[model samples]
Every structure is written in structure tokens, then in C-alpha cells.
Target chain A: MEKFGTLTAIAAAYPKVNVDTDLIIRVERCAGTPREALGPWAFEMVRYRPDGSEDPGFVFNREPWREAKILVAGENFGTGSSREMAVWALARMGLRCVIAPSFGEIFFGNCLQNGLLAIRLPADEVRRLMALASAPASATFTVDLARQTINGTTRFEISPRPKRMLLEGLDELGLTLAMEPEIAAFQAMDRPRRPWIYL
Target chain B: MGRSLFEKLWDLHVIAELGDGMQLLHVDRHILNELSGSRAQLDNAKRSLKPRHPQLTLGVADHVVPTEPGRAGDKTPWAKNVMQIFRDESRRDGILLLDVNDPDQGIEHVIGPESGFTLPGTLLVCGDSHTCTNGALGALAWGIGSSEVCHVLATQTIVQPKPRSMRARFEGALPPGVTAKDLMLALIGKYGTTGALGHAVEYAGAAIRELEIEGRMTLCNLSIEFGAKIGMVAPDEKTYAYLKGRRHAPQGALWDQALAHWRTLPSDPDARFDREVALDCSGLVPQVTWGTSPEDVIGVDGRIPDLKPEALAYMGLSPGQPLAGTRIDRVFIGSCTNSRLSDLRAAAAIARGRRVAAHVEAWVVPGSMRVKREAEAEGLHEVFRAAGFQWREPGCSMCVGANGDLVGPGERCVSTSNRNFVGRQGPGARTHLASPATAAACAVAGEITDARTL
Candidate 1:
């Protein structure tokens, strides 16, 4: 488990808007069992076709994004459906961060839990990064999680909430469990007041 | 920056800032169901805590409960556990509990608006993402986490930052064969899901005005699919007329005051938005998910995408596929998303006296007991049963896999509920999203086809 508010990583740009969880993690590949789906089937829904062949036209299928750490995307990235598989798939695909103009509600939550940093950047800024990534084969960008900034040879920074949970790899349950000491104190202090809640 | 529905409600309700970015904002209403019982309510009970705003909280047992009239709980241990917990906890908190046998019991999202608990120009919160259904009534609503639920129970509020505002104006009459469900599916196909993220979405235009309260609610319910947590339509004469005599709608002098406030809730006529998308209702068709996701959709007559290598690698799908004529073994014509009276009517209209195809197995699940009774009175249930479709009790069966209604592996189905993500129906089951009418036609044809052509 690791937590860093800000860390610089090489960027990968996916400019298509409204990319869904099905594409992020395919249900077919992730099928077999709950535990198996956790690792591979995350985006099985969107990534594969009926005949079980790959759609080469997909943005992530392209060479530029195949192995990049940061995915800079267009408006509404990760929209539609509430499956957490999308987040798990992207994270498992070795994506550490995703910088988009926006994100779907469920996808955003799943991303935070599965440890994929979903960054909401401005449309203009998103386009700027897309241009930089498409400019040269070797072109790259840097993402700073602590400051919520995306910078590269193209310098641009945007500040949003610096929620420390994702950086520290603590999900909702993790955060609640992390407060054990404080919760224990609160419970121990007033056992007589609320007997039904505690043993 | 543009703020989405989440931003508007967050800004309006934020009362104080705590350590870090954690800020507390008022929670006007709290909605809960049986599915979230263990992680949320039961967990909260361990603290011997009481809701800070019991008056604002309401719990209903819908998910994981048998919809049969005499059935107190589902036949399964997992479902029974949660239903019992929901009942006991609501009694303990003195909050309103709509039990499975109670006439009020139904999908929380559907019942909220019908009971007028979710009205125009109010802030609403629930543990379900589709909680955005309140937006149809001109309220700002979104889903919260279990911890957030606990926080709201304890403090009457949860932390918030802000969101950008966006407006999606859908104009023109949605021509015949299209519905709010179809329109929302189209929007997701176009906007790519995250289109409304971190922003409040105000759905306006001629088409929006023409929709019924339930239809409007269905549209708002899918806001989360486009990355927006809150989706609202401003209250108007239509809104006023629908609420005239609802169980909890304002009455007496309170009615006038509520209308006065609702009249001002819409964004200014010329108000600027951070992002804007305009949709034309003239050319849309019946929507259906061809693959494993909602956005992996095609029209009734369309074909699947010419996928790429990366997509194939990610999903194990092949390119150059025809979505049409795909064999389907099942049709589920109900769920919280589209199991209203209209949905039943649409499906029944086709199923009436028409036998389902030899191989097509179908189930028509009502969203609630109220819908079931209504359909029964109208003979919709009889039509389904006659057509060889299973007429089951109300609950969210086949929508989520908590119930015993899992679509068999390697089988294909047409479902009316939202979300076409993989395994959502069952392991290795391929679910194609469609409206109820379309689902019925598929059941009759035993393959992917159009309702109009039926």
C-alpha cells in the first residue's frame, strides 16, 4: 500500500469521449468467477466484439496508449453503467492515472476504489494534451497527483480536490477501518448511552 | 468552470469545512434499500448510533425481497438477511419503513416520486446511483457511499466540494417509437457516459416538456450513466399538475408557497453553462446494447462496431459483426429503470394473444406491487402469462443478480433495465439493452428484431 498526493508519471492520452466501463474492462475476459473477474474481465464488455475478435479502431487499442501510464481523454470519459469492472480493468491494464475532461459518476467512484486516478481537466486543456501526445511518437507528459496538475513539455496545471485516499490506496471501507482508534474511543466513551449499537 | 448537478447541490448544502477537503453539507432526505443493509445500516448499528435527521430519512425494502404478496422475504438467505435488517432498523430509528408486504413497497426510486417524497426544487440523497430519479421532480439528487450514508445518519449531512454546471437541451417531439429510456440511451451513446461528470444537468426543451412525470423521472434516473449525479427538469404547469393531490404533495397555503419557489428553480433563460449539448428528438430509434455495455449499442436495424485489436484484446470480441439477427434466448421486460405501467402495457401490447417464440424464455417483473396490481387490473399480467412469459412478483429481479433469476451462461437476452455491463444478468450471459416493447418483440421472434415490424 502506498500513498502520494503528488507523483509524476508518463502520460497516455485517450481522446474519445464517453468511453464506458465495458471498454475499460471486458466482462468476457473477466468471467469465470468473482475473483477471476476482478483481474481480467474488468473491461471485457466494451473491449471485445461478438465473434470474440478485437476492434482495432479503438483508441486504447492503438499503439500510443497500449502501455502508457496516464490516459488523457476527451469529455465524458468513463460514462454509462455503474459496473466497477471498468475501473478494475483499467487499473489492471497497468493504468496508474486517467486525466479526462470529465467522468461518469459510477466509473469515477470505481476508479477511486480500484486505485485509478481519474482527473477532470478542462476541455481546452484536454485537447492540448491530446495534441501533444499525437505530435511525436516518443512525446510524453507528466502528471502530478498531489497538486492535481498535468504538465509536460506542454505546461498546463489544473487544481481539483487533493483527496488523499486514492494516493494512499485507501477505499471507503479502508478509510472507515483506518479510523479504528477514533471509533473505538467514541464507542468506549458512551456505551451506556446507546446499548443497542454495541455489545 | 461548469458545475454539474452535484456541484449545485454541494454548493447550496455545504455548511462548513472540516479538516482537509472534507466538508459537511445538509442532507435533505436519506433513502435506503435491502441491498445495502449489511455494509451500511448494519455497520452503522454497531456504533449504537441514531440518525441525526430521522424526519429526513426513509427506508424501504425492495432489492433482495420476494415481491409475492404474502412473501415477507426472498427465498434466499442473503436476501432474507437484508430484508429483516431493513425492517428492524427502520422500526428502531422510527423512520418510515415500506416493507415488502406493505402496499407502499416498491423500487425506492420509483416509489419516491410517486409518493411525492421527492418533489421539485429539493435536495435528495440515496445509496443508489439511480437515485437521480428525484431529478425528474425538479430535485437535485445523487448516490452516496455507505460511509457517506453513515455520516448523513449521524450528522444530517455529508462532505462536499462543488461541481461544474452543464445543460443538455433536448428539443422537438420524440417521434413515435422513442421513449425517455430510448432518448437517455441515445444520449449516453453520444455523450459517452462521463459527459455530465461533476456538473449539474438541466434537461430542457420541447421534448422534455412533453414527457410525463414518470417518463421524465426515467430520463433523470440515467443521469449517472453520463457521469452526472444530478439531473433535473424545472417544475412547470406539468410539474404542478402532477403534484396536485399526491400523498405528500404540498396542500393548502403550503401549495402556493411551494409553487412560488419551484417557479424559480430552473437555470436562468440565458444562464451560461460550463458545457452544453443539444439533442434532436426527430431521428432517434429504439436503443439496444449489442455487446456487454450500455454504450456498446446499436439501433434496432444497426450493426455492431467494427472493433479494433485493443478492443478485441480488452473484451475478447471480434470486429465486422452484425448485431442484427443475433439469437436471443431470454427477454426481461422489467426493472426499476423501466418497469412502470407504461412498460407493462408496451410489452403486453405485443404479447397479447401472441405466443412467445419456441426458444425465447421471458419474464415480466413489475417494479412494485402497485404496478403489478395495476397491470393485473388492466389484464397485462394475463396477456403475459398467456403468451408464455413468466409473470413474477415485483422486485428488481434479473436486473441485478441478487435474486435467483440469473440469465444462463452463454445465453443472450434483451433486458429493459438500465446497465448492460457484462455478467450483470448472469455469468457469461450477453444482455442487449432495449425498451419493453422491443424486448417483447424479441421474445416473440426469439432473436434480435424490431417492435415496429412485429
Candidate 2:
């Protein structure tokens, strides 16, 4: 996992709702590609045509927005599948953070583990960000985790463990193993208490 | 403050609270599929000099496994190599791998509980989203990422933040032509795809209790489509009976003890949920997705609604167009969601004396080899074959396009799969998520036809 602290970058607006994991990285693309190389295949159907040509009309296909590091999307983004590849594709595409009104439950968890930040804001506020991102006057936004704010205008909330993990580039295994003794103790007791589960 | 079944499962699995709402929850079972279960995660763990609890882990080659019988000689070289690597890695790591030819081989979600590795009141984790299907047995199961998979493998636990509680009560009796698949589709359509985000949902009330174990599994299988990671049905007599006699189920005295524990796994009468929702199934009709998303659904006889031009263009549907007579090029009857024996029986019943239309290509891929054998023993295979529907080996064929089987580009299909996302069946393949019975009807009609009208 990569450490994510604070950064400022251009943001792109993709206002499509119900953007699913399939759209992020289709199952067909999972077969032959290396994990880190999945970026080119991100949004394969929407970003590319059937003949394997890029759709220039898509948001990510044009201008300075093509190099966007932050994304403002519609509500219910990442609404299907628990494919961690979705986050990998986004990160591979140089996306560090996503701002939406809401997100699929598993996608939210997947983002934290992979060091891709998913920020949930009010729908109206998300609309504002989307507008600002598309406007030539201001195409960039900043997400500062240390201060828990986005663009220094809105304060966001994140749990402490995820926050620390992102700041330190720590993986869950490292954190969980640090307390091995406590885990061992709990297991020793749990085995007897829930003997049926062992079967 | 009464605790729901989800909370009870969570509280029992907690090893240490990491504060900030995150807790280290012990994984009682970890299921893995070929696509998500490469040697990379294990290698990462080995590099860190960490150990793994392989006894608690189970791996299956489903996502990329060929569903054609005697497929070893027929698989594409690439798929063969993938299988070889998975088998080698599982052997090296001592993880139980259900090979493609293994008698118990199947989709991870279907095989886990069928093999009795998924028990009630246990905390289960898998790398695939539909892991929630195991929750039908009263287990707290959800999907995790590769990193989380490695973390759980190395430590026998994964860190997770508790989700809010939700209860969806399905009241009233299901009318004829309506199945658990329809009820679930209706539920998803009623509550938009993201309606249950950030919650663990429990299915309760009259309709859910009346469903058979497999039917309940069908209901919980697509809970992910509704944006829920965990979907459960309280364990009851049906659940216990389904678990008993399974290969990994407890025996004799342990079984008795397990039943006692499972009996208490339901939500307390006074249990309160963060959100409560209800759906009446008395007059529910069969459902079929007309657009890309699962929630973009309507009744079998309903018309397509006015949707975004892009969505409409992608699905090749027009506003106000009747869904019933929509032409379909293929019909798929298998997935973790609707590939159980009951699903097979329903499809067989629909195709018993009818032949698949010449223009349509229909196939039936059972959930597990156990289901395949049972369906064959009951002569369901003969019915399908007689109807011109190909009977294939068990795997997630045509559901996720990783397998060679697919609906060609721009072709329309009626699939008994959980997702209907763009390119899910195949690139540019338009999919209508449906029940097996409805899919069979589509095969016979060479178009989207209601089973009720058959």
C-alpha cells in the first residue's frame, strides 16, 4: 500500500450515477493484465469504443482533465462488486481521491485498504465541486488529510486507524500483527466458546 | 439498546478494538476464487515472514474455470496456465483448492455453505462481493480486497469498521410465477441500487421465512447489487436442516450443540435497526433488467422507462418499449445467485417439453458438481438437452466474461446472474438479469417472455 497524506491536484467531473465496478474494470480485462497495469483499462467500455479506439468525448479523454488526480462523481459511485481491482485501476490512472455523495459499501472499504481515498460529501456540495472542476477558472482542488479538509473549504471525516494507516503507508496485516498476543488470547478463548464454529 | 444478529456476530468476533470505530474481527472462514487468489498475496505474506492459518481458508477455481466437461484438454493455454499456477500455489501454501474437476467444485459462494465450511454465527470473508450469499446461513460474511485477504491469511483476522444495521421485511405470500429471484429483483428496483449503502441487512418477516434455504440464498446473493456488503436471513429449522449431513458440518453431539447456538442467532424481538424497510410480495411479478444496472429493472410485462440517452443507447432500448417481446440471442442459467438445485428444477420445468428457439443459444451451468449430479440424477439434464439447451459442467460460465463462454458483442441475453452491468456478460453484450424460469422462457421464445405467460 502507498502512503497518502496531503496533495493538491486537478479534479475531473464524471457525473454519471451508479458507476459500477464492472465499468471501472470489466471482468474480461482481469485475466491477462498485471495488477499495476490495469490503469489503461479503467472504464474500458465508457473510455474506449468497441473497435479499441478511445472515446474522445469522454471526460478523461481530453485536455488537462485527462491528467486529473482527483475525481468528483455522482452519488452511488462504485455500486457493484467487491473487486479491489477497481481501486487499483483508479490508482494506476493516477487518481488519489474520489469525492461523491455516497459510495458502495465494499468499494469504500476497498479504497481504504488500497490507499485510495473516498470522501463522502453532501450531494449539493458534490455538485458544486463537479461544477468547479469543469470550469476553466479553477480545475484543481486540494485534499489535506492532516487538517481533514478538502480544498481548505470543507472539513471531512475519516476514522483514526485508516487515517494513521494512510499517513504511514501501513497495511492492515502489520497493524493487526503488532497486537498478536491479544489476537492469540482472544482465539484461545473463542475456540472453546464457539466450538461448533471450528467444525 | 437491543443488539441485532449482525451486532452479535460482530461483538463475538472482535479481538481488539483499534478505536476510531475499527476492530480486528477474526475470520472464521475465508473463501477464495482464481481471479482474486493469485500467489502474489501469499508471496507478500511470506516476504513479511508472517504465517498463515491455512486450515481456515478454502480456494476454488471458478471465475476462470472452463465449464465444458473434460475441459482440461480444451481450455485455452492461458486459462490452463492460470489454473496450474493456482493449483501449485494452493498446494505450496496448504490451502484447500477445489480443482475444476473436483467433485465438489463450484462457485465459491455456492460451494462454501454447501460444503459446510460456512456455519451460522461465524464471521466469513472472501475476495468476491457475492460472499454475502453465505449470510443466508446466519453467518456474517462479506467481500474483502487482496490486501485484506493477505492480512486475514497471515493473522486469521481482518480489521473492519462496523456498519449500521438494517432490516428488510418481506411480508405476504409470493404469488405464482414469482420466485425468490423476482422478490430480490423487486426489492432492488424498489430501493435503488445504492439504497442500502453502509448497512448490514437482515431479511425477516413472513416471505423470507417461508422461502427454502436455496431460495433464501438467492435473495441474499444479490444484496450486493443493492449496495449492501452483508445480507442475512435468521437461522431457522430450514437453515439447520440444510446444514445437517453436509461434508464439513458438525456430527452427533457437536451438531446438537451447534443447533442450540444457531437457534439463538436470530434478532431479538426488541432488536432495533438503524433502518427498517418492508416489501409485500403477494402480487409481485417476475423482474428483468432492461438497462445496464440491476436496479434498471421492470416487471416482465412492463415498458422501459425514460432513462439517460447514454444508458438507453448502451442497453439498446427505447423509452416505452415493451420488455416482453424484446429479442434475445442467448439464455444463461447459472450463477452464484440462481444456480442451486431449485433453480435448475424451475428451469427444467419450463423447458420440459419445449425446445429452445433455433435462433437462441441457451445453456445451463449448475452451481456445483453436487448440484449437477443431483440435477442429472433427477433427469433435469435430459429435459434441458431435449429442449436444445446445452448442459455444461459447473462454474460461473457466461456470468462474468472471464470464461470463454460469452454473449457476443451487441447481442442481448437473459442471464440468471446477479449483475447486469455494462460489459458484464461480455463487451457490448446487453444483459437482462432474470430468474432461471424466466430465462428458460426467453430461450423458448427467442425473446424476453414472461414465465407466467408460458
Candidate 3:
């Protein structure tokens, strides 16, 4: 995972509510594709035409937004499927941050795991961000993880653990393994109480 | 202040309180399927790490496995390869693999409870979102991402922030023909998909209590559809009976001990929830989704609301159009959500003595091989076949559309699966989510029709 600190880049606005994991990367794309290769297929359904040409009508295919590294989206973004490839696709497509009013619980976790900064803002704040990102001249926004602010103005709230994970790119598995003594002790006490659980 | 079921389950699983509202949770059961499991295993292998507790994990080859009869020869080389990898990895990691030919093989959520691997008061995690289906067994189960799968595999634990508790109490008994599927769809329709976000929702009251084990599973299956990662029903006599002699359930003295613990798993009286919503199901009718999102649903006889133009345009449906009577090109009656024996029986009852309409292509894919075998022994397969509905082997056939079972582009399908998101069935494929019986009715009528009318 890449460490996420502060990033300043072009942000695109896709304000469609309930943009699920299927829309982020269809199930078909996940069949055999490697994680790094999923970039081109991100939002493939709406991002391309039948002939495999770019759908110019899509915001990410237009002017400066074509180079966007951030996305300001509508409510309930990444709303379906526990497929972590959705987060991988967005990250592999160069999106470093996503600002939305709300997100699916699993998707939010997947984003943190992959170092993609997913920030939840008020609906009005998200709409304002979308408006600002819609105009090419005002599309550039800065997301600073260290200070937990967007554009050095709007502060965002993130839990301490995920915040630290994002800033340091800490491997969660390693962190948990470090607490092996605690885990073993808990199991020692729990095993006799619930003997059926241990196979 | 009594504790909610979620609080009790959380407390039981916590290994350590890693400050900041997060806790390292010890996973009691971790179920895995080919699509996600193979990747996680490969990632672990690449890191040269071994699973901390393979005995606690259960593997099933479901996703991407062909559901056609004689599927061993029918699978694409690519899919066959994926299954082989899953098989090889499960063996290498010492995890119990329910291979493609295993009699118990099925969708993880379906098989978990059926085989007794899922039990009351246990915290289970799977790589699929519909894992909440097992929550019906009075367990705290939810979906996890592939990375979390690797985490659980390597550490037998997951780090999670505590979630709030919410309760949806169905106050009245459901009328006939209105199944648990309808109860869930009606709830999602009434409250948008995000209604229960960041909360663990418990189904309570008359309707939920009256529902049988399979029906409860169907209700809990769609918890993910409504943005709740966890959904559960308190274990009762029905739950106990359902697990009494299943393959992996506790036995002998263990059974007695397990029962005593399970009896205490329900929420204590006067327990407070962070949120509460109540619905009167006495007047509720069958539900059918009309738009892309699961929340874009209406009662079978109700008109489509003028909402979400993109969803309307994608589904090729107009505002104020009655959901019923809309023509359908296909009917799919299987998925983790509703592929159990009861679901099959419900659909079979409707298919009895009636042929599928010539214009519609319909199929019945059971949830598990056990379900398939049980259905066949009961002659349900013959009933479906005689009615011109294809009786297929068990797997997630058309639900995810990854195993070469898909609705054609621009074709409208009535499915028993959970999600109806854009391109969920296939690119340009429009899906109307419904109960299995309702899907059978759509097949026989060549259009969306209420199961009760038949």
C-alpha cells in the first residue's frame, strides 16, 4: 500500500447516487484480471461505448477532468458488493481521494486498506465540492491527510486507526500479529467456554 | 440498561480494545469461496505467510463454477483453472474444501448454516457481502473485503470499529403469499438503501418470529442490499430445530451446552437500540423492484414512482407504469438470497402444472447440492422440468453472471437475487428483483405477475 499524506490534483465530479461496485468495475472484469490491470476497466460500462471508444460524455473523459486524481461523488457511493477490486480499480485509475456524503460500509473499509482516501462530508459540502470540481478552472483540490482537511479549508473526520494507517501505509495484518500474546490469551480463556467453535 | 444482541456478540469476540473505538475481533468462522478466496490465498502465499487457524475456515467452490449439469466438462478452461487454484490452495492451507463435486458444496452463505458451520452466538466473516444470510441463525455475520480475507487468514482476527445498533420490528403477521423476500424488499423500498448504514440491524417482532429458519435466512440475506453489513434474527425453537442434526452442528453434550448459550444470545428485554423502525406487515403485499437500485421497488400491484430518471431510462420503464404486467424475457430463481429448499418449494408450487411461457427462458438453480438433492428426492425437479423450466445444478448461476449464465443485453429479467444495480446481471441487462415464487409467476406469465394471482 502507498502512504497517503497530502495530494493536490484535478478532481472530477460524478454526482450519481448509489454508484455501486458493479459500476466501479463490473464482475466480468474481475474474472481473470490482475489487480493492477483493472484500471482501464474502471467504470467501463458507462465510460466507454460498444466499439471500445471513450464515452466523451463522461466527466472523466472530458478536458482537465480526464487527468483527475480525486472524485466528488453523490450519496451512497460504492454501495454494493464487498469486492475490494472496486477500490483497487479506483486507485489503479489514479484516483487518490473520494469525497462523498456517504459510502457503503465495506467499500469505505476497502478504500482504507488500499490507501485511497475516502472522506465523508455533509451532503451540502459534497454538493459544493461537486460544483467546484465541475468547472475545469476550479477543479484542482488539495487533500491533506496529516491535517485531515480538504483544500486547507473543509475539515474531514476519520477514525484514528484508519487515519494512521493511511498516513503511514501500515500493514494491518502485521499490526494485529504484533498483538499475538493478547489474541492467544483471549483464545485460551474462550476455548473452554465455547468449545464448539474450535474445529 | 440491558445489552442489545450486537453488543453481546461484539463483547464475546473482542480480543483486545485497540483504542479509538476499534477492537481486534477474533473470527469464529471464516467462510471462503473461489472468486475471493483464491486471490487471498495467493496473496498469502506470495507473502510466505500461513493461515493462523485453518481449522476455523471453511472453503466452498461456488462462484465462477459452472451450474450446468456435467459442469466438470462444461466449465471454461479459465473457470476450471480458478476452481483448481481454489482446490489446491485450500488443501495447501489445511482448510476444509467443499469442492465442486462435494455433496455439500454451495454458496458459502447457504452452506454455512445448512452444514451447521454457522451457529448462534458465533461471529462469522466471509469474502462476500451476502454472508449476512447466516445471521439468521442468530450469529453476528457480515461481509469482508479480500484484504480483510487475507487479514483473517493470516491472523484469525479482524480489526473493526464498533457499529451502532438498529432494530426493524415487523409488528404484524405477514399475509399469505407475502414471503420474507417481500418483507425485506418492502423495507428497502420504504427506507432507501442507506437507511441502516453504519448499524447492525436486528429483525424482531411478530413477522420475524413467525418466519421459519429458511424464511429468516432470506430476510437476513438482503441486509446488505439495505446498507446494513449485519442482520440477524434471535435464535428460537425454530432455529434450534433447524440446526439440531446438521453435519457441522454441535452434537451430544456439546449440543446441550450450545443450546444453553444460544438461549441467552437474544437481546435482553428493555434493550435500547441506537435506532428503531417498525413496519406493519399485515397489509404488505409481494414486492418487485422496478428500477436499478433495490430501493426502486413497489408493491406488486403498485405503480412505479417517478424517481431516478437514469434508473427509469436504464430499465426502459416509464413513470406511473404498473410494475406488474411488464413483459420479462427471463426468470432466474436462485442466488445466496433465495435458493434454499423452502424457496425452491415455493417456486415449485407455482410451477406445478404450468408451463413456462414460450417467450421466457427460466431456470431453477438450487442453493446447494444438498438442496438440489433434497428437491429432486421430493420430485420438485420433475415439476419444474415438466413445466418447461430448466432444472439446473447448484451454483450462483445467473445471480452474478460470471459463470456464463447471464441475461442478454437489453433483456428484462425477474430474479430472486439481491441486487438490481446497473449491469449487475450483465451489461444493459435490466433486472427486477423478487421472490422465487414471484419469479416463477413471471416465467409462466412471460411478464411480471404477482405469485398470489396464480
Q: TM per model? A: 0.75, 0.98, 0.99
Better of 1 and 2 by DockQ: 2
Can you tell me which runs of candidate 1 are displaced by over 4 Å?
Answer: A1-103, A106-199, B1-14, B17-23, B67-75, B308-322
Provide fnat values for all models in the order shown: 0.15, 0.75, 0.78
Residues B1-454, candidate 2: write the lDDT tens digits: 6679998888989998889888888888998787777744445646664435887889898988888765643446666666777787778778889998899999998999999999999899998889999999999999877777777778888888889999999999999989999999999999988878889999999999889999999999988988899999989988889999998888998889888888887888899999999999998899999988888889998999997677789888899999999988999999999999999999999999999999999999999999999999999999999999989988888898787887899999999998888788888899999999999999999999999888
Ranking of candidates on DockQ, top first: 3, 2, 1
Candidate 1 vs candidate 3: the DockQ winner is 3
Interface RMSD of each: 8.7, 1.4, 0.9
Answer with 1 or 2, whichever has the higher lDDT: 2
Q: For all the predictions, what are the DockQ values?
A: 0.12, 0.74, 0.84
For DockQ, candidate 2 versus 3, the one ahead is: 3
What's the TM for model 1? 0.75
State how far residue B306 of model 1 sits from its true place (Å): 1.2
Candidate 1 lDDT by residue in tens digits, A45-149 = 444565767667654556655656677776666765444445555666667777776766656665655557777767887777777776445336666665555
Q: lDDT tens string, model 3, B1-454?
A: 9998888998999999988999999999999998888889999999998999998999998888888876743546667777788889999999999987888998888999999999999999999999999999999999999999999999999999999999999998899999999999999988889999999999999989899999999999999988999999999999999999998899999999999999998999989999999889999989999999999988999998888888999999999988888999999999999999999999999999999999999999999999999999999999999999888888888989888898989999999999898889989999999999999999999999988987
TM-score of the second chain in each model? 0.92, 0.98, 0.99
Q: Per-residue error at A196 for model 2, in Å?
A: 2.8
Q: Which portion of correct inter-chain contacts appears in model 2?
A: 0.75
Evaluate model 2: give its lDDT.
Answer: 0.87
